[model samples]
Target chain A: MIARNNVVEFRTDLPGYPWQIAAGDGETWIILRHKARLPVTQIAQLKNITMKDFNWRIFTKALSKTLFQGTVSLTVQYSEAQHHGEELPRETWVDEHLARESFIKDETVTGKNIVRKDSRVKTAFSSILLDKNMLNTGNESPSEGEGIWHLELPWQAWLYGTGKHQNPQVEKVHIAQVGLNTLLLEILIQLTANNELDLLNTQLLEYGLLPREELIFKIEGQEIEQILGVTVQRVFHQPVYDLESKKLQLRNFKEVDIIFISAEKGGERILTASRLMEEMQVIPFWPRDWKRPVDFGLFNKWLGLVKVAADQILFQGDYLWFVRSIEEMGTEKITALEEKRKNTLVAALPPPRKKPGEKWLKKDKKEQPQSSISKKAITVRF
Target chain B: MVWQFSSAGYMRGQEARRPEVLPQANPEALPEVTVEGLPPQVLSSYELKIKSAERKSPNSWLLNTSQGEYLLRELPDQSNQAKTIELYLQFSEQGIANLFPLEKTKSGKAYEKTEGKLYYLTHYRKGNFFKGDDISHLRLAAKNLAILHRQTGGWRKEQGKKQNLWLTVKQNRLRDLLAYLHYLKQNKVLTDFERLFIENFDFFYDQGQESLEHMVLAGQEEAFIINNLLPENITLLDDKLVFLDITKWNTGPQAMDFSLLLNSYLPLHRWDLDLIKDLITQYHQENPLDQKARHLLLAQLRFPRRYWLYSHQYFSGQLSSDELTPKLKRYILECYWRDICLDQLENWLIGEWDKNDSKE
Candidate 1:
């Protein structure tokens, strides 16, 4: 009789969704509803793993009894494509160091005009992998592009510790508010179905690359209005105290913005706008002499820059924001901002009181005021 | 000031709500605790009959007489009886429902040291222990915690010294695990199973360290925390929730206490977002949390505690698959849902507290 523990069921309710397992059924084919991809260079590369092949007993025995709330009795069975195939496409092993050098060369197309577009993903992946503490650093090779193992993007970002990113303090705050991993998994599951792997993967990849930074260069809403030649009403407004200045200021924050400019030919024009961090805006660049609606070819060029430079970009409405780190910055200012916010919150709270019969509360000395000035929401123009 | 409840129609002999509530035995089934050296006045001229006895945890008994029921509790050590009495009295004063030690002994003491054993007697209240799945019960537990913390604020301030009481123990355990894994490898005693555990240690340790750093950054300690806020320790009465074990209370961040409750309950519900939101909202409504406190709670939840704990046990050669496997399964399941829950909880908190945004 089968142990019943070996039986496994997979929930592929969401495409590109990681597996949610439960123990049931004696027959051992765990179906993948979304066509879970395996980089199958050849059929011979496939490795069929059965319950007897590994310690299915340990995992099933562990997961079944308590968490899934019942006994999981089954023999585990699964197959995956591996690197070395028995027959066709036999590849020679090359030195990884040499391959890395070649990749760098390929990354720069010709004559100092780096192939920035093609190498952007590699760069982002490399930056994330270089951090020794990130969980991804151990499993993923920075230089390797195609692999048997691929982590869906924002999930990948989470495994790479949030603090290891370009803006640690902001990411730290962000991670605390909505844990990166859970937020992404839940949102992705809700937004996509089993057949939408391609869309889900693309969205995940894009959203995972977006980052949050304090000194950001956004085309101020009014400036965007001037460029698009339209009067726009802000829907979401907040009174934010800017970290740099001590004045309170009202600002509009949008998760995503797409501006449509009428082309001379008179159709529809689409220009995606994303915030670029101040430090990365080394060269003043913007689309110029672009006809409305903007040419698709030209827009793609602008989108490339947005993809690489922006820490966070909202690609579509109600979809996840792309979060990534382009350049590492000193976190001193961010840390100071965090401390100030906490102190402000503490100050706003009602003072601690002594319970009746607890005389010590009355005897306590008053807390000392913070020496640092509170940051203003509005920055003074120089 | 405690209100009495009638035990009628209460299903008196059924298993109490918690798993920790041992099966109740008949009153005559067990031998009575020796009251040999205790002053006669402590019993107050009533014949005390044992209603229930628990030998495993804190060694206590439920006693009933013609007047009313009383709980006779035994202390682990005679020296700490005074401290226990003091804490219970403070808890009672703060509107926390606790069995305050009765001041009936001849010496006007809350506890009596008889024949080198320490014991305290208090009026027992009838209540059902809390179940992890009871949403209302969970909400009440969190609200009661906030109230308890608010009341204990003054006491927390008096004990001004800061202590990372478990830091040394955890750090030492991590170091020992590393050494043990190395020794196993060097001696050719490592199995494939052991190798898998060894491979995962770095990631788990690093994850644990990252969370610990976040806690240090948040500096969240403020209220007197009940170190063990397990669901079993909370009981639901007709009108109020009563705390069972008061012996493990300590001074620390309320996050530490709340996180323990959340962790315990998360697995029970398989990390249901609606339930988690309800629990956190109830707690926040009672005790408002600022940015720092929220982050501290997240940090506590985010810590790779199960990994560190089991790895420590494995290194100590104390890990049995029966216990560790189920916990690991629950950990994985909760981790899968952690981020989603944290995000919603944060948004709810920010939406509530962001007065300027709401006004705009």
Candidate 2:
């Protein structure tokens, strides 16, 4: 048995059988020929241990459960014999140079290091042939000289040390008016809840390297597992001021420190920051009290009554009710005023008692007979 | 104070006569008209006897003739009319079946000039307006637009003119926005719409500026584009999508059409990024876009075109405060979702470029 990292090589001494290797979380067994030599009995025992001890289903189920923690598990079934003659020559120049530059200690460096540090390991793995038919174990029709292998492991395990899984710390310091920042935060929270932060984290890692003026996420037709890929360094929430306030305090006013990850790399940060400030400035300073209308029961009742009255006037032509409402409110005061005027008039002029057939008009004319003549004389003088 | 007083007066008037409570007259009623005033020579040229005529708009007439229904339109500008007729003929020659072909007169001319006005006839097309609810319809429209773009790619070259107003348009929008801001500042008392505009002014102004910057960054690749892809301009005729109007076609980046289509359809879908991605993918599948074209598309989408349009209309007196207020409110709501979509699209585009770089 030859063990290196997660891969273990076993020499099958059976005449026609080739050497077998267990790799990738011990879920896959590959048949191949390697330089390592081992006893025939030990190789056979190792093969039995690989095939009999490992439970693929239980291992996969456990890995799937960990997917919510930003780990992706994939089961890849491939074969090596189909690509036996087509394998490209492995290039070891770069790896050898790097290994030579580093200090090699006998105590730390072993056969495992030699295999792991060599580029031939990757080249060998890359030669593992895969086709549509080979992907399905039940329908795999192996051609002549083909060796079938099942490789099941979390695809993201290789990226463990690459810093691709690190999620950006999105801190919302001050958000005004529940606008874009709030919406973005909500989306992030949702993505995290759905266990889709893996894709987001990976995209954000890429985004941090190449930041644009605007970090736009295409949400149209995005699958459930796809990420929004927005890299917000820090969100600085500031107060929304009206245009007048902003203009008045232009000199003294301090802008929000909105640090978009891309802003660090580009010279357009000032423009972006100022734009954010302007966005804040234009947001009308809604008074805290005015966040929601005061829900007054009396006011609501009055509004309802007014609405009903309006409906009646417009649709039913019911003006009588409206007039009656006004009259009812002023009825007592009007009656009292009328009574007082009646008393004053009665007291000023003596009440005249006329016979049933007497003409009140003729009496009035007789009393003011000279009045008409005076009026006519005054008119003539003018 | 003046705005408040006006509002109070409007409220009183509204109370006195509620429009919703009152019975409304049918606005679709077509006025009956006789063909007595129509030019006899023009009718003879078309070789048709008009049975009845009804004015569809100020310059268009729906005529029932011996040969099926036709739209008799009065072309206002002779030069533009000629160019339009030429384009129509070109389109027909290219086998674009979406556009309606003009009926030829007896002399084999597209138009007939009688008195001072030039008139043209086209067979009336019947179809339902594009409501943008179905994905299949959107995909079809996108694919058709791609085909149209491919055919019109060399239109500017053939015409021997470079009508690239991409930057000019952004400059004008920015200018209008500044003017609008000045107008708002000059007002002693601001209405609700004016106040809202002032509140949201900076954000949109920033967007306008960014769009200009993007236009500059997006290299010049001129192609004839349909500038107006409004829902009203598109009609679904059977399984195919037909463009009802093509007069607004101009030479610009192919992305302009994509932007216009998004502007028309995004709001209807509540600015779904998935829908936009699907649309772009469909279009890209038909006519592949380069890096510059994609950048231009992004730049066009980033601009607050609708916001600028509404404010411009209000400031220009095309729309009153009452008409603009509700539109502004609805627009503000749309911006909330639209901003999210824009952010998502930008990130996606950057990712795409990164992938391409890695591949290279």
Candidate 3:
């Protein structure tokens, strides 16, 4: 299994952030642990500082994708510099194990009642990834990049999510170990389909798996033809899978260990060690939108479990992710979030509601809670 | 001849440890194969007359009687691509050239897939492979080829698609070669000889291309074969040279056949232009070769180690290293890229002489 997901930023808290939600069984995730004062934009080296800025994607671009081979999800993160001193908040998964089998039916905490959400990511950026391959000890290496990195398919034993793959079968079975920041080599991949358009760019950029970096093979009963170099240099922009075809017909692969091999002139022998199961937990129900309020049916479920400090907002949901554009917020987001020495933060959140039917408009909550004002909806400006 | 070499055949004992890959229809034993469709009289003695002609390929049996010979090729349980190639050879131009038409079953099927595998029976051609001294048969063989090419020169439409019989120097391969040349130049693997080869290649490839304009043509975008000349397929019978598989674009650049023969013959007899000239004159008299064709042929005199390696692996099964033809070890070294020092066309030809000298 190859891990692919970009994390834009990791900060404490901000107003009106976007998040996303994706659903699948055992997907390779790029889960990021929010660390402030890290030397990404500041010193460009490892150092410790603290900032209580909220890190998340911009509004309007939280996308939820289904798996390719089987039913699953994949999230790709990016960065947008336009957002200034205020960006979105860092993503944290609420332990799904806490979800009681009877929780969803409880009307007060239904899914439709959550406050905010994100649908897809607009900006590409550096991120820490988490996948299902690691143990939950928060021990995993983080990947940094702004480019989309799609995995070579069909995966072996593990299932893969969506990045416009041809096969819409739901999940891809990947047999190999794939952790965050792990690179795999000698993975012979063909288009999951045989379409003229599908094959147009399957062998270039990230899509091209041929002439892999490190491989060992020879014809039977012939002199060992050590194929040391690639006949062609192929890479791909993005791999497209059709939601129509339920098959992952990627070609066979020769396993090559590239741990010690040179990066130049070798068959595909490198493995991108990923961190999914270790540092990240797949939230059972997270918001997948920023512009639109969480559907009335689903929002209630999110508002119930989110914990908060002074300005910190920690809400966990399943298969949901978020992202945003900096244009909405100014550059102060990067400055305020650059270097602060706080592990976490506190923030204001709507007071817990016992249930939707209970009349909360009894002149309360906000400083100017409406006195029985029923205008269908009132915009809550943060 | 059933290749009597160690590396060639699959013996019965090899499968002892593994479970017998029994036919799908009947897992207990070898399924009874009763092919239908032959003349009733031919079927009368089918089981009784059949004899085990190939002992190593145990499943393949031959049924022989006074009427004619029928070879039943059985598909083994394990069907790898190698078996597929063997089957192709069994059904392809090999058995066809020998004047053996497969027996069609009553249902007009070329083969019957018994238990998820295909097999067919055909009459075997009864003729010994022409040895080195069969000179008188060269003309007859050449005439047969000219006739075959003349008769079947045009492509055929099989299953509504055009079928070509010739193979070209695949353009992709040519591109690969050019790229390889660049790589050699870039990696400093190019030697003086290899540099000379580059010049000669540019010269001859152009010549070959020019001569081929009239003689050999490229395949169509839809489908075609060009430059399909190989050694074993070209035979001499009764002083006539015959090209066995002469279909579609495969029939052009007639010098290619002569080139391949020379490729084999040069190493067999080095330092003696007598035999070379004789064969040249013979081939020229039979089928006149143009100057461009001749120059291109000479330029191609240097065989790529890629093809050499294929041949070394092919013949090592039958002939001992000493009994093997000359220039073999050089071919091996060349295949491994160690003989790049002898990249010059002259060095390659000299390898034969060097081997002959060592033999002396």
Candidate 4:
């Protein structure tokens, strides 16, 4: 069921390979090599399983009774042909993959290298015709053996999908690639959920899955303006996530990509890229970690309160109300702390000594006659 | 009033009445004992033994006494020194201590009245004169003024009467300007000052009228303002501002103080818009200013106050033709830069107002 721009073809030229089968939408292709003859019924069942229903559990269960022996390899590719002429160089993709691999390797908890050797950029030549619209301008005709670089993953067909799907069909392939990071995240989440404190604590140290490198894809400035609903002068990315200390928990994809937006008028706002993605409701595989610190929840509550106060300022045109609210909150906090201190240690402390001039000043003021005039009746005229 | 004099005070009174103890012809020389016409009973009433007395201004004296150094000044005709003292005492009671309260006499009177004149004493404060050139000083002064405003703002609920004081002030000035124009036109032979006043009359008249219209539109809020907030009246001592003069405190629009401060200081900076903005922001941090207050402030700033002042002075013969001509010329030249700054400020204010309106 591949589109015309994403036709996958198989070659049976190699000597050791008997059956060469390829099936997928162009970005993610499943290549199968069978030692035993495959039945027509099993092939029909495999075809019926679209990418949405395709998951590790379903794949394994569907093939449980099949008396077949074969190897299934998954290849994920990013190419200009698949995207709408978006140029993601093969070198850039390879660099990102290596960076992610290095990040996983640097983690002390995951001491063993989890990245498989087969998960590398593998060059393949395909003369499959593409839709005219898929071709880049000035390249009216492409020759055979055009280099198509792709990652040949060691993952079997059973480990391919995790059941999450994006809205647009085209983003499904990229979402599948992102699912690899999600899988690693899921392990951490499950460890935490299962109350395996010792293991979870060990893994929580430097346990990020995605590379903290800048992404090849960028959200345009106009899109950012739409998300913030403010006139943006400039947007800056400030990366503050620390994988070694695990300071900022990996609750969202691209959490470190914090946007510092300065508006045209005079104010500034900071927002996380993950928060923006959450607002956009895109990026399906971004799973939020449920077991967050209580401080984070309180901080979010304060942020919401500030936003409500700001709305009050805007609606009522009483800016002082917002300032007073903040001051009151501060005063309440200080008073609460002072009360705690007074209850604990104040009784043991000696009373503060009066300054040398204090007594005299007090006596002098006391000696003055109380005026008969009411303050309300007194007005100083110029 | 019955004067109570102690046995020692009778002798001091006899000594103060001597001609040698009176004000000398050379003001540079300190008086031997007491100020001119200051009754010895007034000094003895405060239990003050004067060491030396020096004239500081027309009706003020710097006195060093056995008690302490003090500034003794006479109040003007419209001044209610008792009410001023009460207001400041109330302010001090309310924990607003920026102003120096009036020191009471031994009889607990706020001021001593003798020969139909009112005189009061206060502890002499020492500080450097406030510098308008220093931005930090400007910000501090603005913040302190705002604090004073906030304290007095509460009084609005209790005592302040709502009045369009700016409208009255602007109308008076405009009337004076029109009278000056008529006087200049009536002159059979125009002097240089009269000629200059006639030439610049139309532009300044339009500006005055425009500001009056703006004031009318802004209406009024009950605001107790320090009417004379000149830099000379503020002192910066040990990072704390001491408002030296509280006698001119009056009930008016809150913008009156802000406008007065800017008018007094903007000439030092040649009317820099950013500096004005910064000062406003500093003030706003302490006490929030509404859009109407800002409009009134801008309106007051836009009016050609100096133009009117010089013309009125010249027309009333308070200033000679030779004296008024140069001052008016310089003022007209300065108005170019002033107008540009005011226009930019107006644009910014309009833009902000529109932005807030759109938000609503």
| lDDT per residue as tens, model 4, B1-360 | 111111111111111121222111222332336567576655655646678888888877877865456778776534466577666555533445455445566676667776666777766666778876677887888887887777667676334444554576667667766755554344322355554566567768888887876677674477677765555678776656767777767677777777777766666566788998888888877777777777788777777777765554455445666655555655665566678888888777756756865798
List the global CA lDDT of all models. Answer: 0.38, 0.43, 0.29, 0.44
Which residue segments of model 2 deviate by more than 4 Å? A1-382, B1-37, B49-55, B63-69, B157-164, B182-189, B353-360
Binned by DockQ into CAPRI classes (incorrect, acceptable, medium, high), candidate 2 is: incorrect
RMSD of 2: 40.1
Please give, for residues A1-382, the per-residue lDDT of candidate 1 as tens digits.
1121121111111112332211111101111111122332211111111111101111122211211111111111112224332211111111111221222222211212211111111100000101112212122222223223222221111111111112111010000001111111111100001111122112221221222221222332211211211111122433334334333233343222222211111000112232211111111122232222111100000121121122221221111122122333459977977766654321233344546886444443576643344433533222
Docking quality category of candidate 1 according to DockQ thresholds? incorrect
What would the per-residue lDDT of candidate 3 be over residues A166-222, giving only the tens digit for each residue?
Answer: 422321112111111221212111112121112121221112111111111211111
Alpha carbon deviation, residue B235, candidate 2 (Å): 2.6
Candidate 3: chain B TM-score equals 0.44
Residue B213 accuracy (lDDT) in model 4: 67
With a 3 Å backbone cut-off (N, CA, C), the pairs that clash in candidate 4 are: none
B202-233, model 2: which lDDT tens digit per residue? 87888778777767768546776666566666
Give candidate 2's chain B TM-score: 0.79
Stronger candidate by lDDT (1 vs 2): 2
Provide the clashing-pair count of each candidate structure.
34, 18, 168, 0
